[model samples]
Target: MTRRSIGIVLNGVTGRMGYRQHLVRSLLAIREAGGLPTRDGTLWPEPVLVGRSEAKLAEIAARHGLTEWSTDLGAALARPDVSIYFDSQVTSGREKAIRQAIEAGKHIYTEKPLAETAVAATELAELAAAAGLKTGVVQDKLFLPGLRKLKRLIDGGFFGRILSVRGEFGYWVFEGDWQPAQRPSWNYRAADGGGIVMDMLPHWNYLLEELFGGVRSVQCTMATHIDTRVDEQGESYAATADDAAYAVFELAGGAVAQINSSWCVRVYRDELVEFQVDGTEGSAVAGLRHCRVQHRSMTPKPVWNPDLPNSVPFRTQWAEVPDNDEFDNGFKAQWEAFLRHVAEDGPYHWDFASGARGVRLAELALQSAREGRRLEVPRLEVPR
Candidate 1:
């Protein structure tokens, strides 16, 4: 067995995403799992911590008992010890770091929205491919248990011909009026690549494509529902980005998808996020962790009475979706897949090309919203 010792340079390891999702849950957890086993029955890569703050990096390193650390990304990239560069930085700052990492000839894995614009993301993807380095972007929602169940149902033809998809995704991210804000302040600034449409459309693009087909066109409207929010410093800042967006997608397979993402909405259901898929033969509704299905043949028909309040068709039609343990936390599952791709030489599906496509979708949605016109999505030869 050939033991491939992988050295990973972790950028943006000090952020909230870096701490819980990347460090403790992914890299550290893999280390605890005795590393990812390769086809030859040996562990492939080991993680090393890198960040901007030496103190915070040192703190995390101490917590995880990791010794390899660096504050200089350039130095880390140049090190022979490092074989992979992972970035979880703010959306605005991801491009430069990833570009440099690719030039360094290391396999790259990072979070979404490859760049602020579609062209830039496309360029980045080209660069990584030209460099012959393996690359992947985080597309965690597809691995979610609820979404997985929905995918299974779709694959098995449970819904028959798909008609439409409706999604509601949001929760109040509290302002720092009493406590510190949970998200980055730049997330509300347009200059910093922040907006509900830019932040969320990518997820829907992949989801819609996976469930139905590629998006042929989109119509969207975006708005800044909250004008001002206080940060941890007790200073009020004017919000310059859209906090809410309503988008409609026309899929190539004739399926329509409507997505509403907001920062001001309150959760009043099974989860903060939910979706309803209506098809020719049946319909289904899925929350963050659960879903229910109803077939037309199984649906009880009833008369519609405006005066009579209650309806019978709704009461007896829907059935609780059976629980399956194949799914886990979306992020964790993607992380595991990533490790497998690195270790076992497994085919990596969510590569840089896929990431670029997602960014393209977001850019197109933003353009459509601003111009008040529908935009066509260009199909790319993204790797499967």
Candidate 2:
């Protein structure tokens, strides 16, 4: 059996998502598991941490017991051993770094909304295509156990001729005055390329297209419920970005998807985000970890009797979807898939173009909200 090592230059890993998910949970976990198994041999992932703060990068490297850490991106890219570049940086800084990585002739994997704007994202896609580089954008939700089960039902024709999809996603983020904000302070600043719309609409766009039909049009409204919030330093600043977004999307198959994404709403559901998809033959509600379904044959009949006390067990009517296979963390799953794609030239499609489409959705959603009207979601063409 042959053995090989794959060096990955990981940037922006000092952030929470980058450190927890990409580092500890995914790449490090893969490394600790005796590398990723392949037909010929094993592919070991070696992470070369890169960030603005050398101190923070050194600390992380020390914690992981790994040594190749650098503060200069150009120096990291110069290493011939590093064949891949992974970025989990802020939205505003992603495009330039990705462009540089592409120029350096490295395969790339990154967080979503590939760039702050659609134009820059398209350019990156074009550049990568021209350079013959393998690229992937994070679409972690698609790999969730619940979504996988939902996908199984869709494939099995359980939801024959799907009709509509309704999703509710949110939890109240404490203002820094009372409690330190769970999210980064930059997330609420528009100047820093922040907002729930930019952060979430990309997720919704991919989820809609990959599972159901592609989005044909969109209508949306956004709001900033909290005008001011304290930062990590206990200094208050204006929350200029929208904290909530209510959107209605029309799919190509004539199905409608209504999604409400917010950071200010209280949670009453079983999960942080839940999607309910209804069709002619059945309906299913899926969260991050669980899925519940109701067949058309077993659906209950509830008449309009507002005067009398309701006795029907609406929630009990649906059956829980069993997990036939043990589920790994969604981020880890995607990381393995991407690794396989890079190692063996496996099939991968969540590319820069797909991410650009997501950015386009957010841009149009904002425009739709401003105009107070529905807008068409046009086909995106990346001119290479």
* TM agreement with the true structure for every prediction: 0.94, 0.99
Q: Give the root-mean-square deviation of each candidate in angstroms.
A: 2.0, 0.9
**Considering summed lDDT, which 10 consecutive residues are worst modelled in model 1?**
309-318
* Runs off by more than 4 Å, candidate 2: none
Regions of model 1 farther than 4 Å from truth: 1-4, 311-316, 381-384
CA error at residue 343 for candidate 2, angstroms: 1.3
For model 1, what is the alpha-carbon lDDT of residue 165? Answer: 94
Q: What is the per-residue lDDT of model 1 for residues 35-72, given as tens digits with 9 covering 90 to 100?
A: 76667765645667777789999998888778888888
Q: What clash count does candidate 2 reach?
A: 0
lDDT of 2 at 162: 99
Instruction: Show the lowest summed lDDT stretch of 10 residues, model 2.
Output: 375-384
lDDT of 2 by residue, 238-285 (tens): 999999999999998899999999999999999999999999999999
TM-score of 2: 0.99
